[model samples]
Target: MRMQVDDLSDERVQALIMNHLESMALHSPPESRHALHFDGLRQPDVTFWSAWEGEELVGCGALKELGAAHGEIKSMKTDPRHVRKGVARQVLAHIIDVAKERGYTRLSLETGSMAAFAPARRLYESFGFTYCEPFAHYKHDPNSMFMTKEL
Candidate 1:
C-alpha cells in the first residue's frame, strides 16, 4: 500500500473521511463522537494522510497540533473491506512518524470507551500509548477514553 499525504481538497480523501465520520457516528455515542467534519480536517493545524492500494483507498488518519509540543491523533479508519490487513496499522505508524518528524514531544488521542472500540484501543496500546486524563480542551467524559505517548 502507498501512504500519501493528501490535502483535504482531494475528492477521494474527502469521501474516505466522510465515510469514517459516518462509521464513527454509527458505533460511537453522540457524546463520544470526536471525529472531525470535513471542514475541521482542513484546518491549518491538521495534517491528513490516506493509504492507497493501487487506486483503492485502504485507510486514512490525521494528526492535529494541540500546541507547540503536543499533538492529537484524529480520524483513524480502515475501509471495512480492508480490516485485519494492517491498513490502520500502516496509517497510524505513518502518523506517529510524522508527528515525531514535526518535533511533537507527545501525541494524544480520544477514542470511544465502548466495546466496539476495543480493536482501536488495542492498536494504540500496541503502539505504546497509555491511558491518560483528557488533554486539550476535552473535559472528563465517561464515553471517552484518552491515551497518550511520549515521542
Candidate 2:
C-alpha cells in the first residue's frame, strides 16, 4: 500500500473518519471518546495520512505536534474491511518516522480502556509504547488509557 499526506477531501477518507467516530462512540461513553471529527483533524498542528492500495483506501492516521519535542498520535483507524492486513501497522510506523524526522523526542496517544480496545493497546505495546499518565490537556479519566514512547 502507498501512504500519502491526506487533505481529507476524499469521500472515502471522510466515510472512514465517520466509521472511526461511530466505532469509538459505540465502544466508549461520550466523555471518553476522543476521536476527532474532520474539523479537528484539519487543524494546523495535525498532519494526517491515508494509505491506499491502488484505488482502495486501506487506512489513515495522524500526528499532532504538541510542542517542539513532543507529538501526539490521533485518528488511528484502519478500514474495517482491511483489518489484520498490516494497514494500521504501516500507517503507525509512518507516523513515528515522520515524528522522528520532525525532531520529536516523544510520541504519545490515548485510547479507550474497554475490552474492545485490546488489539489497539497490544499494537502500541508491540511498538514499544508504555502505559503513562495522561499528557497534554488530558486529566485522569477512567475510560481512557494513555501510552507514550520515546523517539
Candidate 3:
C-alpha cells in the first residue's frame, strides 16, 4: 500500500473518517469518544495520512503534536474490507516514523477500553505502547485506556 499525507478533502477519505466516527460512537459514549472529526484532524498541530492501494483507500491515521517533545496518535482506522490485511499496521508504522522524524520524545494515544476496542489495544501493544495515565488534556475516565511509547 502507498501512504501519503492527506488533505482530508477526498470523498473516499471523508467517508472512511465518518465511518470511523460512527463506529466509535457505537462503542463509547459521546463524552468518551475521543476520535477526531475531519476538521479536528486539520488542526495545525496534526498530520494526517492515508493508505491506498491503487484506486482503493485502505486505511488512515494521524499524529498530533501535543507539545514540543510529546505527540499523540489519533484517528486510526482500517477499511472494513481490508481488516487483518496489515493496513492499520503499515499506517501506524508510518505515523511512528513521522513522529520520530519530528523529534518527539514520547508518543501516546487514547483508545476505548471496551471489548470492541480489543484489537486496537493489541495493535498498540504490538508497537510497544504500554498502559499509562491519561496525558495532555485528558482526564480520568473508566472507558478510556491510555498508552505510550518512548522514542
C-alpha RMSD of each candidate structure in angstroms? 1.2, 0.5, 0.6
TM-score of each candidate structure, all chains considered together: 0.94, 0.99, 0.99
| TM match of model 1 to true structure | 0.94
With candidate 2 superimposed using the best TM-score fit, by how many Å does residue 8's alpha carbon deviate from the native?
0.7
Higher-ranked by lDDT: 1 or 3: 3
> What lDDT, from 0 to 1, does candidate 2 have?
0.95
lDDT digits (tens) for residues 1-151 of candidate 3: 9999999999999999999999998989999989999889999999999999998999999999999989999999999999999999999999899899989999999999999999999999999999999999999999999999999
Whole-model lDDT per candidate: 0.90, 0.95, 0.95
Clashing pairs in 2: none
- Per-residue lDDT of model 2, residues 1-151, tens digit only: 8999999999999999999999998999999888888999999999999999999999999999999999999999999999999998999999999999999999999999999999999999999999999999998999999999999
Candidate 3 total steric clashes: 0
